[model samples]
Target: MVTVNLGMLHYVIDHVYGAFMHRTKISPPFFSRGWGGSKLELLERLINQLFPDVEGQIWPPNLIQPMWKTVWESKNACLREGVFRTPCDEQLLNALPPESHYARVAFLTPKFVSPQNMACVVHLAGTGDHTFERRLRLGGPLLKENIATMVLESPFYGQRRPVLQRGAKLLCVSDLLLLGRATIEEARSLLHWLDSEAGFGKMGVCGLSMGQYILLLLLHF
Candidate 1:
């Protein structure tokens, strides 16, 4: 014979129910579907091997000029897009085409350029998101204040998505890890480019979901 405390039993039942619903819910997609425990361990080892001892400036050592091509011009704002080529932290993939081995950025700036004291926000969209949600949100408001805006499409996203992948989100966890490695490096290069440019002395970053988390990580990096 056993006696169960009603309060404790209710709490345990609620937690169990919540956990079941959480794992069963399909609204928030997962990128690690094909990654098994062993594969996750492999990813961990690879990361440790590459970054066992790391020390360097986040900005690029050699700041280079990026060719900014105006894709769209309007009375309110202008859009400039360009690709910045840089090496990844590791050689995970070989035989990548020159065009595919680069990072891209789109700059949406006010029609009027202020030499100084102008604000600029770097907008990072969600992971696997083709839509520039953050840019769309900030474009109008920021431009109203005479601020500039830029969007960075994540690696393995947008046109950068691998042809082998069927969807926007990655199926292989290892591939996703590799993308993270390169994306962070490319983001650092972006900072270098911005630092050299005028009116970027004051900079801010905005992101959504995973992108928001990336912004937080960039602060520590």
Candidate 2:
């Protein structure tokens, strides 16, 4: 019927699959910064209308910071081995900007920081897989540039295991899609917090494979 490569699979995962899963019917604000600018803007506008009160909130204080001791250790391993398990704290598992409000949203914080750079570029991994060697190769330049980085375990991948490991038993992709919306909302909450607490303003997003595809959809519709 249809030929599928990693690239194609990623596209379906980000757009078709992701959309079906994240069916909230909220419109996003439209703007031109990258691609699909208009559609994402419309969707953002819709989200804002639906959730007007979901304003930017402050990040949790050190005391309230969601414990990620396990996540922290796993992140260390990701530094060493590329991919790490998802943190148990599901509350922290969302993307910033909530897609509800058209706030200045940015994803991923660079491992490195450089004042000379005005723009931050991010990389998104596919299938929640990476090798320590790959991280070393890919992460260095981004770090040098001080680009922000974020690692998301897509519904069935990475730290998104608890929900996905059920394997065709409990929930299918459709079920996971609902979870995906929650993840996006969570991400938005985190983004708002970062904006208020970390002082990171609007920046660009560069998603590899599925992430890129998602970014494209974000740009278009």
Candidate 3:
């Protein structure tokens, strides 16, 4: 008789699935462009300047106010889709690919709840998560708790993905760093909007996998 470890089997299955899905010939491997020379240098300089041997020293000097354009609304007005320009600083903005300049967001809330009576949580993306649909569905059940979900479409995925890049595989190593920095800036701005402009009583940020790492970095500020 052969005994198989269920956990190990499960891990093997996951890896096999991921390999087929993400490592195919049609799907380019990440960092195909190698370590981007100038871009990597710029990022390193920025990091050193921001940190300077001090913990939690990095923070956005100003949050750009989002000018939202509504894309859609549920008939009951509980779900809405909107987009705004990414609130990254000029230096970071110039570094980003053109398509990633704008950010898309989806809001899911319980109808008839006042902003002060409800809470909103901004959801960040895991690796390769390209759309708001998955996050929206995950958040939908929380409506019963009067918690609203704000799903952010990350740069380098969905409509923001660079044209030359294949699927979620970034073209350069520096692009990964760029994506994280841009996401933090955008998320901070969105949280500011929720607190100051929308007047939500309570707010939070959450993410999965890579997004969780980004959330940890966001906490530094």
Candidate 3: stretches off by over 4 Å: 1-13, 17-26, 38-43, 49-77
Q: Pick the candidate with the highest lDDT.
A: 3
Q: Give candidate 1 misplaced runs (Cα > 4 Å).
A: 1-33, 36-41, 49-64, 90-100
Question: Which scores greater on TM-score, model 1 or model 3?
Answer: 3
lDDT score, candidate 3, position 140: 80
> How many clashes would you count in candidate 1?
0
lDDT of each: 0.66, 0.38, 0.83
By the TM-score metric, which is better: model 2 or model 3?
A: 3
Lowest summed lDDT over 10 consecutive residues: which window, candidate 1? 90-99
TM-score: which candidate is best? 3
Q: What TM-score would every model get versus the actual structure?
A: 0.72, 0.40, 0.83
Q: Rate residue 171 of model 1 by lDDT.
A: 53
- Reference-based TM-score, model 2: 0.40
Q: Candidates 1 and 2: which is better by TM-score? A: 1
Q: Which lDDT tens digits does candidate 2 get at residues 121-184?
A: 3344343443223333554456545554544334443333343233322223232333334334
Q: Enumerate clash totals for all models, in the order shown.
A: 0, 40, 0
